[model samples]
Target: MELPEPDTASDDAMDSFLDKFQSQPYRGGFHKDQWEEEFEKIPLFMKKAPSEIDPKKNPDLACLQSIIFDEERSPEEQARTYKGEGNDYFKEKDYKKAVISYTEGLKKKCADPDLNAVLYTNRAAAQYYLGNFRSALNDVTAARKLKPCHLKAIVRGALCHLELRNYVEAVNWCDEGLQIDATEKKLLEMRAKADKLKRTEQRDIRKAKSKEKKEQNQNEAVLQAIKVYFEDEDRAELYQVSPKSTLLQVLQHPRYSVKALTPAFLVCVGSSAFCRNYFRGRKVHQVK
Candidate 1:
């Protein structure tokens, strides 16, 4: 077949290059013309080709639609192409574009459970990176629903819940995910934090309850002591009796056992001995 004649300007440029290259006399057996002929056969080598930019066009939804209808490319290849583009977008941190690419890929090959989980999981990661925790959780949930055995998705979902301050749900998700893959370090860490928070909250609640109980008990004790003091004849009569009468009664009372009251009366005796010892040591040190 007669290939289209080379463009005349390209042909002239090639001839000029070869002429200049051959004019170097010391370079022998270079076969500059033959080399030029061979180079010309390649479409790109002949000239500086015009740049072909992929126009900054809106996503070609039509092309995607046609790809869906076309039976030529295997479903796997189509998915691969979409996923490759999606990954490229992800690397660029263009998460919205990446999600679109992954979603389109999923539409083509919905039956691939692993791929579905991976796409959704990746989208969830992007969402999380973008600080859209709720959306990320949704994607993770969708992924887990499709592939119930997806441990990574479960962990990521738990993390998302944790960021959203749903501590109980986060712990629940981590617990379930750990049931499947216990060695997941991040899941364990997240669960530990959630449990710690729960414990701290519980401790605060218990402390409050204990404080109220103590106050109630103290109030009840004060009431009982007041009632006893008012009703007891010795105390009540002491209030009415003169000091001399009380003293006489104390001296005369048969139940005023000094031995029984000895321990109670010695409450300050131990402290007095310790204070004397401490004061003597201070005095000796000052003298030294």
Candidate 2:
């Protein structure tokens, strides 16, 4: 492409601008009040970079900016470029910007499994640093789908599971990572930690279940005794039942069947205020 010749007409204009500078010094452009506009134009003072860079407005940056996301490039190439940009941001610890760049790379939907997996894993790292563990885990899952034995993805997934308190799942993921690279130190350490947590959780569960079962058995025993005393009259003891009855089932039962009809004996089943109150409230014959 031929470079456009500089307009000679601009020479006359440039001379006039220089002539004005020598004749009547330009005060308006140099004034402190006009400096605010210049400050606003600088990127350092600006809150954010312009989304759209106009060549006329930013001629210096136009070429570089245009080349950064050239529409002529293939999606795969564009995605790769974005990955590089993301990596730069990641190295600088600008994780939020890195996540945005990686997301843009993924949006390209490149057919290269390796490139896509890398983008996913990189995004997972950014999200992880940003405290979005679930999002990081999801990105890790995507990376693993593209490359099932991805050690980084496995490590990230295990970490996410650990944060979420899914100790068993974390151990499983750590195991998967160890399978691919047995010598990986991170995987080894994570697996050991996760395994310990999983075992502790299981032991606690077992203890809780055993204690619950014991309590249930005791409650069932108490209920069964109550049933025998109230419904199965023959299960009552000799003094608990009518003193006239003669049955082995009466001597074998453990429930209280208080207030015998005869005065020969008083059935006071040990320190039971509830039973005493109930007996007092009853209209049945009471023998002192």
Candidate 3:
């Protein structure tokens, strides 16, 4: 199919190019008589392959696309084409487009385990590059399910786990991978890093538990040492108490009426019947 001439730099350049194009006789070498090939050499025709065909604007590009995407191709063949397209985008570092292409390949349901696994793994790589660690992890899981022991998927899954700070899981995944290939340096390194982080996390948890236990013990001791007293006007007198279970015993002591206190001992009857009937049972709690 024929493509239009390349656009020129300016009006003057366009007029000059037209004059030269019209006046010159055919002396083509490599692209002799191949108009599409010659037009492609202009860096304008199909330089960026159209994602969708538009024959009106880019007939050559559209024709190229139509030829490549005929109905004769099977689902598996189309899927493999998408996979190759994704790989090309990946090599160019166009990760977002690569992910789109890979996702399309997966949607084909090619019924080819190897192809599907590779598609998932490739899409996972693209997702990882985009900083979608959880999504990348999910893709790796799908890839692994399709083909267990897929080394690239295992490596990518471990990386995602590490990024998500699932330290223990990262270590376990690395270990699983190492079991498949003990000489894998990437797995060995990841395992070492994950194991160290997991150990640190465990140590920090243990330290926090110990500190909490110590504080609790100290608070309990303080509660045990608090002395009970009964105040009569401004004169305070000690109330009988035991070292252990002092508050419990005092609250649960045999019935004692606040009004029955000796004149020297003063106790106000509380508003509530339960509170007035029981010895003052409110606890002023303090925890360290």
Q: Which candidate is the best by TM-score?
A: 3
Where in model 3 is the C-alpha error above 4 Å? 1-55, 222-288
User: In candidate 1, what are the lDDT values of residues 1-288, reduced to their tens digit?
Assistant: 999987999989999988988886655443665877545434445352122322233124334446654668876667767777778778878888787787777778756777878888888987888888998999999999899879989989998988887888889998998899889899999999988876787788899999999999998766443310011223322111222343445434443334544411111222355534533523111000
How much lDDT does each candidate structure score?
0.68, 0.78, 0.77
Using lDDT as the yardstick, the better of models 1 and 3 is 3
State residue 125's C-alpha deviation in candidate 3, in Å.
0.7
Q: List the residue pairs that clash in candidate 2.
A: none
Q: How far in Å is the alpha carbon of 18 misplaced in model 2? A: 13
Per-model TM-score versus the true fold = 0.48, 0.61, 0.63
The alpha-carbon lDDT assigned to residue 129 of candidate 2 equals 93
Q: Which ranges of candidate 2 are over 4 A from the true structure?
A: 1-59, 217-288
Residue lDDT tens for model 2, 115-168: 999999999999999999999999999999999988888999999998888998
| Model 2 clashes, total count | 0
Can you rank all candidates by TM-score, best first? 3, 2, 1
Residue 275 local lDDT, model 1 = 37
Candidate 1, clashing residue pairs?
none
